[model samples]
Target: MRLHEHQAKKVFKDFGISTPEGKVVNDPDDAEKIAEEINSPVVVKAQIQVGSRGKAGGIKFAEDPKDARKKAKEILGKKISGIKVKKVLVEEALNIEKEYYVGFTLDRGSGKPVAIISSRGGVDIEEVAEKTPESIAKEELDPIWPLHDFKARKLAFKGNIRKEAIQEVSRIAQTLYKIFTDKDATLAEINPLVLTEQNQLLAADAVLNIDNNALFKQPELAELREETEEDPLIRKAHEYGFDYVRLDGNVGVVGNGAGLVMTTLDLIDYFGGKPANFLDVGGGAGSATVENALDLVFQDPNVDVVLFNIFGGITKCDEVARGINEAIEGRELPVPLLVRLAGTNYKEGLKVLNDEKLRVVSDLEDAVKEVVKLAGE
Candidate 1:
């Protein structure tokens, strides 16, 4: 789960990190009021989850309250990265003398949290890594041990942080690590941690992504989720208790396990077909669950064909077959369905599908080839 910038900065402030004071407003009038209250040049920033708001014209600077209202009006109804700008963060603008980047995220390769700092900030870190790798500093820390100030200072030095700002940068780095571990976050990033003309440090922007699995443990953080940031089909799938992800393909895939779903997608791609979505019904999926999954798949207008690949271990194949049949009963299916069932109650399941006059395949590869051909036609 990802928190919006204002939300992330609020969390950071709670943990002793300095950030520019801001107000989140949904109305242009409120934005103007907040800017007036600040009594300084303010920045109006769209609160969408995606990045590059500035490039998208979702970010604007206002010289005064009236200008703030104008800027907010321009951004309020616009869509950035397909998400509507329902809210904007209005904050005092800083006169940045220098900027740096600091972040902490899990390193899957080493199975530990890694801290990254860069002298060059205010841009995508991936670009920095690709264009100027030498300016970034990275450190992999032990999960059991706390990040020490000395280590953070060393990292700051390596990133070429100015000597005068090194201590403050190190302190922020340490605080960032604390937030990462304390919140069970997968990523905590502050881009353009800036030094003002007065040499004071502040976090100009904040981003935090909490581990989905850990949401149960952090109720408050979990409540900050914004459903608008998710694809509608994906959100619907979640409501039905299935795992789903949208993809850029025409074939819709439904399977019993994550691995099976992944393999189904790969097979579709290998055979000159594209998968429109990844839907995992999970273990022991019943008739209702399968029906729900199919409903979600058909909701995508891009789907040219639907494939159900079920290897029933705990989930009875007969139940899955019933679900498939139930979904097809009352509505006109816009696309064809290709099903491959194996494992528990496979005979009964096959009988159900056969009785319904649905196309059934025993071989996985044959199923893929047949679906691709049908989709093409």
Candidate 2:
């Protein structure tokens, strides 16, 4: 799950983070009204989930209400990064003297949240890390303790923040950590945390990605998800109650566990073929779930072959075979299926697949070679 800029800003404002005063508008008149209410030089910014709105001409500056209306008309309904600009955030424009980057994300190696601050901002962090690695300051904090005042102060000093701004930055970092933890967010980023001419700090732009597993606790945040920019097959997979990620290959994979699905992908690649998608039916998948997974895989024109690798422990391989049989009988499969069944009821599972006239293999390497050869033909 991911929250749009407007929703993320709402969280920031609630946590005492100073942000540009803005209101969302759906039309030119609404933008004009907001401009009048603010009574300042306003910026009309398209509200889409994708980045680089500035490069895509989705952001426009207006000196007055007339220009604001014109900018809104030009932006509304226009596509930016393939997403139609349905709403615009009309915000008071500020004169920025300096820009900084502030973000909190999980450090995979450390297995904890890491707070990153950089003086060089408003550009891709990856590029900055590769080109000028020294500019970014990172502080890995304990999950139980999270960010502390001492660590926050240390980060400020490392980032070369001014003495006067040290306290403010420290406080901002603390609040940001709260936002990150309390909301169950995987990433909370504010690019170009700007310093205004008046010497006030504000967040000029924001991006947040929430942990999908934690959406049950954050219903309000989940509402901010934009489905238009998402892969069609992926969206459909979710709707059908399965996990799917569209990949760039021809082998379609269906498995019960995450590890098995990954191995399936790797084996396909090992045999000179790329995986078309990663579809995990999850434990206890029934006939309906299996049918839906097959539907999604066959929908992909890129998929020439399907692979079902089932390692049934808590998830019975026999049940998975039944689902596979149900799917094959229910729909016109556009591609061939190569199945490898192991663990509980492996023999029974193999019997079911063989009965369906589906290609069955016991060895993963041999299955990969056969599938790759079949797809290439």
Top lDDT prediction, candidate number: 1
TM-score of each: 0.69, 0.67
**Candidate 2 Cα deviation (angstroms), residue 85:** 2.0
lDDT of candidate 1 over 110-227, digit per residue (tens): 9999999999999999889889988999989999988898999999999888889889999999999999999999999999898999888899999999988999999999998989
Using alpha carbons, what is the TM-score of model 1? 0.69
- As a whole number from 0 to 100, the lDDT of residue 206 in candidate 1 is 97
lDDT of 2 by residue, 237-268 (tens): 87987767776678888888787898888888
**Model number with the top TM-score:** 1
TM for candidate 2 is 0.67
Question: Which residue pairs in candidate 1 collide?
Answer: none
